[model samples]
Target: MLKDDQFWISDDKAKLDMSVIKGYLARSYWAGQRLEEIIERSVQNSLCYGIYRAEGQVGFARVVTDDATIYYLCDVFIDEEFRGMGLGKKLVQYITQSERFRNIPGMLGTRDAHELYEQFEFRRDGDILMRRRPDHMRS
Candidate 1:
């Protein structure tokens, strides 16, 4: 987990530091399986992947949306060197503005970050969402 500092997510059209971004992805759990594979899968699946860089890559997130009225936001991460700087919140803001996600119902999971999501109007309605881990992955 990233410490609470030195990170910032941006919606600006700034040049991305791909090398650093790749480094972070390479160290991620499931994503570390293969950077090329992960990038390709994200593109093919129509998932929007965002990376935060400050001196290096500090955060990442992917949004699954249909360019319509429903969006499943997932896989948000902030590198250990960068956290608590609002990068994750900024990334969510950036993704929500897309024509595909604007006005759509968005959802995500977080062991933490409930406060950040609250700023975007995300709420826990008990009936709003649920999940089941793959049987094979369950302990």
Candidate 2:
């Protein structure tokens, strides 16, 4: 059972068989790959992760790190059906306030989520924002 404030979250994929994860991602425009593969990839890259509910992966957030410090937050997603209920805020708070994340200076890029992250001290600096998506993956 997963709660908004719980650290340990378990989804059906860890126990029973279910396709909801894949279905959710497919509907969300995540390109290719099956549910199990996606789940495996997410698990592999996260320093720590949680899967909410038994049917769907309502949210996911990961830390890109060099182990000791310097962590980059990436891949934050909250299922469309589950948005607007403060779940995203809770997830961000959990990630940034945790002891594991406190010492590390966390960084993330967001299109419209600045308000939520602002509560966690994430500010939209007007100095410099840069990206370099390679040609092969150019948009």
Over 45-79, each residue of candidate 2 has an lDDT whose tens digit, in order, gives 56544456645456766667774546776556667
Q: For each candidate, give its TM-score against the true structure.
A: 0.59, 0.63
Cα lDDT tens digits for candidate 1, 16-134: 44555566667766457775766656635656444544465566666676745557776566667657666776676666555456566677766556667666666754543423222
Clashes of each: 2, 0
> Best candidate per lDDT, number?
1
Stretches of candidate 2 above 4 Å error?
1-42, 126-139
TM-score of the candidate numbered 2? 0.63
RMSD of each: 9.2, 8.8
Runs of candidate 1 exceeding 4 Å displacement: 1-43, 127-139
Candidate 1 residue 131 C-alpha distance from true site, Å: 13
